[model samples]
Target: MRLAAKANLGEGTISDFENGYRMPNPRKLAAMRRAFEGAGVVFATRGPTLTQPRWR
Candidate 1:
């Protein structure tokens, strides 16, 4: 269920996204952006350094 209930998308839609069977429409993407923005989520871009940490 969408938090604002304005998206009106079902769980099946989310499932399709996770399964790579469907993609988010531009409207949905805008709604998500609005939601995240209202929630104070900051998106940033950071480049990796010459020496990156290894997971292993």
Candidate 2:
């Protein structure tokens, strides 16, 4: 998701998170959610049900 300008973070920092080079702090995670929301996007996590498991 594209972060908001007011997120006050540099592009490289975000890139690192996306590339798995870094994990964002809780505050930054909240900011990212807000940023996506501002852009009319929503982020979600989904997992399979207990009755259905898939191999990775």
Best by lDDT: 2
Q: Please give the lDDT score at residue 33 for candidate 2.
A: 61
Runs of candidate 1 with Cα error greater than 4 angstroms are 1-8, 47-56
Total clashing pairs in model 1: 0
Where does candidate 2 stray beyond 4 Å?
Answer: 1-6, 44-56
Q: How does candidate 1 score on lDDT?
A: 0.56
Candidate 2 collision pairs: none
Q: What tens digits encode model 1's per-residue C-alpha lDDT throughout 1-32?
A: 25334345666765687689989888876776
Task: Give each model a TM-score.
Answer: 0.48, 0.62
lDDT of 2 at 2: 38
In order, the Cα lDDT scores of the candidates are 0.56, 0.64
